[model samples]
Target: MGLLDNVKSKLSPAKDKVSHLAQKHEDKIQHGLDRTAHAVDKKTKGKYSDRIQSGTGKAKHAMDRLAHKDDDGGSMSPPPAGGATPPPPAS
Candidate 1:
């Protein structure tokens, strides 16, 4: 394999491990994100409230994607509990 392919092969296991952890602790991860966002907003005294909220929303959306949860309330469902076939993407 080429250099990039070699690096990707070596990192595959680590990536899988991280993905599993993220899926397993998705709720806790989301909670931590919210808590941190709240703390930052408080510290900033609402000056950047809008920006903070936007960033927080983006972060939560990313976490949801990582956890394979559908964002749009469309027919697409969340990943099955057993980690079988993943759900389809929303339109």
Candidate 2:
């Protein structure tokens, strides 16, 4: 396999584990993200409130995607329309 494929193969197991954990503790993870964002916003005295909020939203979205929350029954979602190959089916 090519270098990128080799690296991906090595990391796939870790990625699946992380996805499982994220699915299991999704609520806690989201709460932590919100709390951290609030603290950072407070520290900056709202100077970057908009940017902070945007980033928090993006993080939460990523977390949901990782957790497969957007898919039915927690199955993997289809690949994006950008012509990338989908991940292999979970064993």
Candidate 3:
């Protein structure tokens, strides 16, 4: 098997498990995201309110998609691009 295929096969079960968990605990996940965003906003003293709000919205949307996986248990929805908002974490 190709390298990608082999890795995918090995990780398939784990991925499915995560998808199931996400679906089951979607509310908890969203709450955590909100908490994180709130903490960051507090730390920044609202200086980046607009940017932070935009980023938090994107993050919540992405988490919502993950929590509602498709029939194949894969994430098919694409997240909203941040555009000029907070840049994504560097790889």
**Model 2 C-alpha lDDT per residue in residues 29-83, reported as the tens digit of each score:** 9888777877777777777777877777777767777888446665655533322
lDDT of 2: 0.72
lDDT of each: 0.64, 0.72, 0.70
Each prediction's RMSD to truth: 11.1, 12.3, 7.3
Which residue pairs does candidate 1 place in steric collision?
none
As for model 3, its CA RMSD to the true structure in angstroms is 7.3
Candidates arranged by TM-score, highest first: 2, 3, 1
Sliding window of 10 residues with minimal summed lDDT for model 1 = 82-91
Per-residue lDDT over 35-60 for candidate 3, one digit per residue giving the tens place of the 0 to 100 score: 77767877777777678778777776
Q: Which has the higher TM-score value, candidate number 1 or candidate number 3?
A: 3
Best by TM-score: 2
TM-scores for all predictions: 0.67, 0.75, 0.69
Question: Model 2 RMSD to the real structure?
Answer: 12.3
Model 2 earns a TM-score of 0.75
Give candidate 1 regions above 4 Å deviation. 69-91
Question: Can you write out model 1's per-residue Cα lDDT over 1-91, one digit (the tens) per residue?
Answer: 7999999999988866776787899889877877777777777776776777667766666556655633454244443343221222222
Task: Score residue 49 of candidate 3 by CA lDDT.
Answer: 68
